[model samples]
Target: MKRSNRLVALTNYFLENPRLHKQLPYFVNRLETTKASVSEDMDIIDAVFRNEGLGYLQRTTGAGGGVKYIPEYLHEKSEAFIHEMCHQLADPVRILPGGYLYMSDLLGNPKTVREIGRVFASAFSQMEIDVVVTVATKGIPLAYSVASFLDVPVVIVRRDPKVTEGSSVSINYVSGSSRKIQTMVLPKRSLEEGANVCIIDDFMKAGGTITGMINLLEEFNAQVKAIGVLAEADDEEEERVVENYTSLIKISNVDLKAKSIEVHPGNFVEIGDRK
Candidate 1:
């Protein structure tokens, strides 16, 4: 293969699977080129990535370190990829009784979760998103996956206060569906003033929990660049508060009697230009 094509292939490989970049030898073995040639190609790829404003290609120099690409590449390809996945998640059969949709399997599957995380991270790639925030315990994995892609930190919002979190600020917000009051708390110093935060969650029933997160972000004087949910329960009434947020899938309804479910992509993908 030509040197230029090799570089592109190498960079794409790293973008597709970041963990492999941690082992230099493994990444090197994948190529039929010399170590010196590989190093030079990586440098060229990194420059191309930066020049294009796609983000940065990070290289850690250590015994176990390898090369990884932090996607700065904003392209139509990325949007198409995300939209296709969103459509898959729109299956009605995935829904359960009581207006609930099953997403634990998707969350536990690293490939799916990583793709979902990348889609969100790419959306906020240009923003100064210092942290990825989510409420426990289902949202933790999504948060972590996004943080990894964004190369940022993940902060957890605990339902119950813990001594480890030190002093926390708590708030009570109305549930979007249940209409019952639910509480969400965050550590007082978890975020800095003027920090940009991207909130992620596994699912949305009433959007009450997300609103609570918004309120918490406000308390710290932080800015919410965007909100992402794995799936949203579709009820025109309950979805009012979440009109501004983004979701991978929308569950229109779950009819237990008929054993029918409905799902579709949210507005985020349709409107996201990511320019």
Candidate 2:
């Protein structure tokens, strides 16, 4: 293939397969090009990736060394997106009953979700997460998107047991926002022992659900490497349960009577370089 054609294929391959390692000879043979040519192509791609703040190519030269993409959504870009989301979320139209938000439209947008995933994936890129975990329903898409960029698998925790999944480990925990006891179930085979886990969720209110998920993960000896939420309720009246979490936006105040809402960037911006 021509150098230009080869470059396009190489870029697509790395983007589609993040963190996938292969020897230089593997690419040279696949592209029907010489080692020196492939090296030059990689250098060009690497420079562009870095300059564009997309990610960097991690290249190693030894016997087991190879190049892989480590997608890091630039901190500045992440901050800008967070601010834009905050502005949109502050709209009074987003206020729902009981001070909840109407964020389904945003969550349903593939582009938005992918962008959110990239931000979270970038924040947690340094962690060696084996799987992206989330509760069933809303969080599934976000989890899959993050896993896509991280080149990891996703494990979901469900509210009810599925007999088809065989024996499951279930735990009852109190909901952070509702303050009601709820049960969460996970299949025994869902996660391997001692797997590093990153939890993703759509929203957090007092972080009860996330805390519950964390407790449940302990049953399988899974390590919680990171926690990310799209939005978090910032109600001082309610005591926060989960710390060490990254949130994209904060709903500071939602007044039902006034039909107004307040939002801002999450804690991730304040706490620099959590990695």
Candidate 3:
């Protein structure tokens, strides 16, 4: 094929596979091109990617060397997108009976979920995570989205035991909102010992559920690498059980009787990048 065609194909290949490294010879053989030609084409692609601030193409040398496409969501773009989300979430019409904001529509949108997942992946790209853990409910979509970008598996914590899953390890924890005892369980074989886990959730209020998940992880001898949430309730009177977590949006104020709500960008914007 022509050089221009080869360039387009090469760009598409890199776009399809991100955060993975391959040897230069691998691409050379796949494209039926010489090392010199591949290197030249890569130079052009690398320049375009860097200039666009989408991400960077990294090249290495020596025995185990190749180019890796590191997918990144630019901070400025992410901030702007989140600003729009905040506005939509702050609508008074979305206020629920129990001071909750309706977010089912946003969570159901594939395009929105994909973008949110990209942001989470970019934020935790530096960490070594073995799997993404989440409860068996609204958080599943966000968890799978992050798993796709990270190329890891997702382990879901269930409220009730399943016969198909075989034996499970169950625990009881007090709900922060209702202050009532609740049970949560996980399959015995769902996670490996000493694995690094990233916990994700749809919403957090007082962080009781997330804390229980942390306690469950302890039983398996696994380490908590990170915690992420779609929205976190910021109530001054109530202290959250899980302190260290990244949220995409913060619900600072909610008045159920008055039908009012307020939202702001989450901590992801401030502490997303790794040093």
Candidate 4:
């Protein structure tokens, strides 16, 4: 095939199978090309990917030589998208009761969710994550999106376990924002013991829900490798229990009486976690 056609096909394959390693011979046979030509193509693709602020191809040599694609979102893209989020969230119309901002619309948009997934996946790209875990409902989509880029499965912690899911582990904890007791469950088969886990959530207020998830993962002896949040309520009155988390946006102030809201970039940008 021509180099133009080969590049398109190779790019699509890399995107479809992120982090999947394949031998040079495999592509050489499939593309009907010489080893040197295949290597040149990879160099070109890697250069373009890095230039576009996507990600680069990781190539290994020797007996186990192969290549894998890493979908890392660039800092510039992440900051630009987060600023747009701040603008969208600044509208007073998003303010909800109890000084919480309505984010269901943004979370529901596939494109928006995918963008969030890219930013989060980029931030946690360096971790050796076994599974992406999230509570049922709002966080499910985000978890799946991140898992897709990571090439890992998603384990959902639900409010209640279904009979179809077989046996489960359950725990009760206090809600961070509401300060009410709540229960979350995960099926016994959903996660293996001592697995490396990356926790993803839609939003956090005082980090009660995230703390609960961490406590539950302990039962399985799972190590929490990383935590990613789409938005966090920066309520000064409530002391946050969970630290060491990456957030895409920070909602600092929400005034119901004045019909005004304040939104800013989250710790993800402040700390420069992504390259």
Alpha carbon lDDT of each predicted model:
0.76, 0.92, 0.88, 0.93
Kindly list the per-residue Cα lDDT of model 2 for residues 1-275, writing each as its tens digit. 79999999999999989989888989989999998999999999999999999999999987887898899988999998888888877889888888999989889999999999999999999899999999999999999999999999999999999988989999999998787999999999989999999999999999999999999999999999999998899999999999999998888778899898889888888875564
Which candidate, 1 or 2, would have the higher TM-score against the true structure? 2
| Shift of residue 218 alpha carbon in model 4, Å | 0.3
Task: Rank by TM-score, highest first.
Answer: 2, 4, 3, 1
List model 4 lDDT by residue over 141-228, tens digit each: 9999999999999999998879999999999999987779999999999899999999999999899999999999999999999999
Clashes of 4: 0
TM-score of 2: 0.97
**lDDT tens digits, residue span 1-81, model 1:** 568778778877766664334655664677776777888888887787778655566788867766777775354555565
Give the alpha carbon lDDT tens digit for every residue of 114-215 in model 3: 888877877787798889999989999999988877778999999999999989999999989889999999999899998999998999999999999999
- Cα deviation at 273, candidate 3, in Å, is 9.0
Going through the candidates in the order shown, the clash numbers are 2, 0, 0, 0
Q: Which consecutive 10 residues in model 2 have the weakest lDDT in total?
A: 266-275
My TM-score estimates for the predictions, one after another, are 0.73, 0.97, 0.94, 0.97
Q: Residue 268 error for model 2, in Å?
A: 1.2
Give the worst 10-residue stretch by lDDT in candidate 1.
18-27
RMSD of each: 6.7, 1.2, 1.8, 1.3
